[model samples]
Target: MTSSTPSSPLLPAFGVGTFRLKDQVAIDSVRNALDLGYRAIDTAQIYGNEAAVGQAIADSGVPRGELFITTKVWTEHLAGDKLIPSLKDSLTKLRTDHVDLTLIHWPSPGGAVPVAEFMGALAEARALGLTRQIGVSNFNIALLREAIAAVGAGAIATHQIELHPYLQNHAVAEFARSQGIHTTSYMTLAYGKVLADPVVQAIAQAHGATPAQVALAWALQLGYAVIPSSTQRDHLASNLKARQLRLSDTDLAQIAALDRGERLVNPEGLAPAWD
Candidate 1:
């Protein structure tokens, strides 16, 4: 776990993601993950599974203090007046008083909302005990700079982005590093695409591990926190073991050569200009 500052919330290196999951599927996935020793969970307002995730958490009987819960505010809620209120609404759905981390889901749908306005409101949310820390997702270099200007560098705890072997996103990752902001690599497995790569498969064979574990270990070795999602209990349990699958320099290099800038999360209007 790491944080940009002393007061920043501690973010675990691995967690379960609830992106496309919903209803009973989300509940079962989250419950299975928690039961398999996963202590962190990532969800967002747009995911439409916050309440299900909340229910899974309650049913697991995991103490709130031992878990790190993260949720994101959608683009519609980026306005200064709406940010905090929407987060409160998210809190209600999550069944928690405060989230470990809260991120702006995207950069205000083409910057219609100024970074300062929402960042200030998010900081206010942290100050008011609604969230322990604040961060952003899908922000590019320019947008990250604007956010850093709105709140000091240390205030932005983590930058969640679409990163994996195919789309390494070195520039944004480097910039985040220079600012001391932790990077969360969403889609770290490239949504199962990379799991079939010959290079990844070879590495998996050499390590005697699953391809999913190899991909996750690569991201973990690069210092990025990963929240890989899986509905199957076997996959969830297997993915958690990635933390222990250390990659050698040669293995890392083999996977690094697989980078081809193949991004998979770009949307028509919501995605920003990528770095």
Candidate 2:
């Protein structure tokens, strides 16, 4: 149950995300990611893949001390009584005593659960050594303010959101920066939509990197942590190499221009009033 320092750096610039991968797919993907030198692995209760991810980690033989594992509390578990227990279940399924980072998957659906209730519980989880850090994902400016009020900004580790070349999410990103909260860019590739963008492809050709790398590097250059997922080892390896891909100012600007606020992860009735 021991964890790294609370003030340890924000998530690594690169990691593997297990959003939809399940069963053997999840296990193999996580195993490949670790084999390719990836230490940070992101999973969530809603993904239905925690067990598989756990199995992969156990099989990887990588030291737990060397990994940064992140999991999110699903909406149904936001209640004060359920938050910690649900996280304990996640720990069990993840086959670990404590995760490096834990996030509120989304703001309680329909505001049915107050931010104070769940955030307080999440903070309590950290105090109890159930998790090393706590954060919120898919929180807009208004929700971020409420969360900060519930728990100081310092306790809110990162605001993970759907961000990419097509949907820059400038408003939320800017707001999080002002409050000193880090942002993690999920779907940074826009679910492969951005990879086909002619601009991105051209940039990739110029750098001799894959389009996926170009997208990831752009986000990383913006100081946001990225967790792109893949089932193939070659693709996984190529994506990890994005950490070393440096984009020119011109490349950044071109990609910036591609932003049209094209968000792809919004769910009906569950989405917050976005910024």
Candidate 3:
């Protein structure tokens, strides 16, 4: 609920991610999330549910200025000519003039499109008021370097990645921090895998919080923004409460020991060489 500065457009520390959600399910999930005090929502063109998300936002009756919405452009549309048009289509589907933040969903497969082309196009999108801020997802240290070269680090608002206890991705996160680009942790729960981990479960018990809350609190404590998705109303409400669950240094260290570099979202041909 903080204000965005000219330099760093604020991304809420916590938000709801709509990845595979679709149709009425997506709409209901978003509506429930909004009703539960979630002001930030994350979606993407590949998710195929922007319209539902937009409709939910519209039906929520929340003022546009009161919410933060982020969406990504798929890799196929990374070309300079396609980027803005795709974003315009996304805006039309999203029922907004501009999203708070927009991102390159992933690096082009086999380097089909250079980072410079898309990054520059993304900057153009911002200049044209299609989006208020620009960023990249699934980018490694090297890819981030290329993005920075395309558009100075100051122009990039955030670098979202799959960060969790199992796959800390410290190298990428550390480098991004050095550049002053915020990191958003997508799939912070490891798609529910971490929710059953004994270490996370134990920490949750000690704090009287759920394992999901422990994982989210751990990411937040590390200065990373998290977008955890869920369809169940109770789960969504409980996850939002993670903002209030502060983990102790001991708890953090214990969770840190659980890292195994277990990445769960790498797709063949689309993922970059990870750090």
Candidate 4:
């Protein structure tokens, strides 16, 4: 795969995420997101819904070239020999030969797989045309450093992380930015938690937007790509409008003050040492 120009955005500024969405529900959600003008879709091997997402993509009637699909390789498949084959399986399930970007879903539990092994394998997968770009998710500053060392900064495309107002993760985001690795904010709405925050709601009311839109806009304005998932058509459509909702300086500062380092996705045995 060819490298992207430096000026090109690493990923879509706004996209749809498919976590916990399954079966026909995943299909209808993806299909509806497409109809509402969402071009980027995020999924994972562990999500167990790639086939459903694939079916939705197939039935959407949208040309493949117009879409940007991203999927992750589970930690169990990080071995050098296993990575590519596993990604191939993901491709078959996603109904595509190549994904726009492929990421290490999380660091190997307890560091069982060395960073070089999986990063090199991911690089190989990109070279083999299985994915156009490669990246890592849920990595802290130290892990990001190790990932950059393993793959070289230029080989990395982005760092997908849990970055909502409540869990700003400034250290990791700052490190990624300093190295030119774009940050993709997952759970930008904080699993609906931020949607109910008084500050977020106030900002939304002031902008005539929903709290979800305000949250997404805050992340986008900070130059981090956001994937906010929704199963509702109205919510999906409203989320996309965030690209048009520009927050004022006060609004941005107010949301920034809401950061409390509250992380919502840490699995006891799987989470890394956060930065």
Q: Considering every candidate listed, which one attains the maximal lDDT?
A: 3
Where does model 3 exceed 4 Å of error?
A: 1-9
In order, the Cα lDDT scores of the candidates are 0.91, 0.91, 0.92, 0.90
As for candidate 2, its clashing pairs are none
lDDT of 3 by residue, 1-275 (tens): 11212224477888899999999999999999999999999999999999999999999999999999999999989999999999999999999999999999999998999999999999999999999999999998989999999999988888999999999888998898888898899889998999999999999999999999999988888888989989999999999889899888889989889899999999998898888
TM-score of 3: 0.96
Error of 1 at 52 (Å): 0.4
Q: What's the distance in Å from true for residue 273, model 3?
A: 1.1
- Answer with 2 or 4, whichever has the higher lDDT: 2
- At residue 52, give the lDDT of candidate 4: 99
Q: After superposition, how far is residue 199 of candidate 3 from its true place, in Å?
A: 1.0
Where model 2 places Cα greater than 4 Å from the true spot, the runs are 1-8
Task: For candidate 1, write residues 1-275 as lDDT tens digits.
Answer: 11222222477889999999999999999999999999999999999999999999999999999999999999999899999999999999999999999999998886799999999999999999999989999999999999999999899989999999999998998898989998999999898999899999998998899999999988888888999999999999999899899888888888878889999999999898887
- Residue pairs clashing in model 1 are none
Each candidate structure's TM-score, on Cα atoms with residue i matched to residue i, is 0.96, 0.96, 0.96, 0.96
How many backbone clashes can be found in candidate 1?
0
Q: Per-residue lDDT for 163 in model 2?
A: 96
Tell me the tens digit of each residue's lDDT in model 2 across 1-275. Answer: 11112222756767899999999999999999999999999999999999999999999999999999999999999999999999999999999999999999999998999999999999999999999999999988999999999999988888899999989898998898888888889999898998899999999999999999999989888888889999999999998889899899899989989999888989998998887
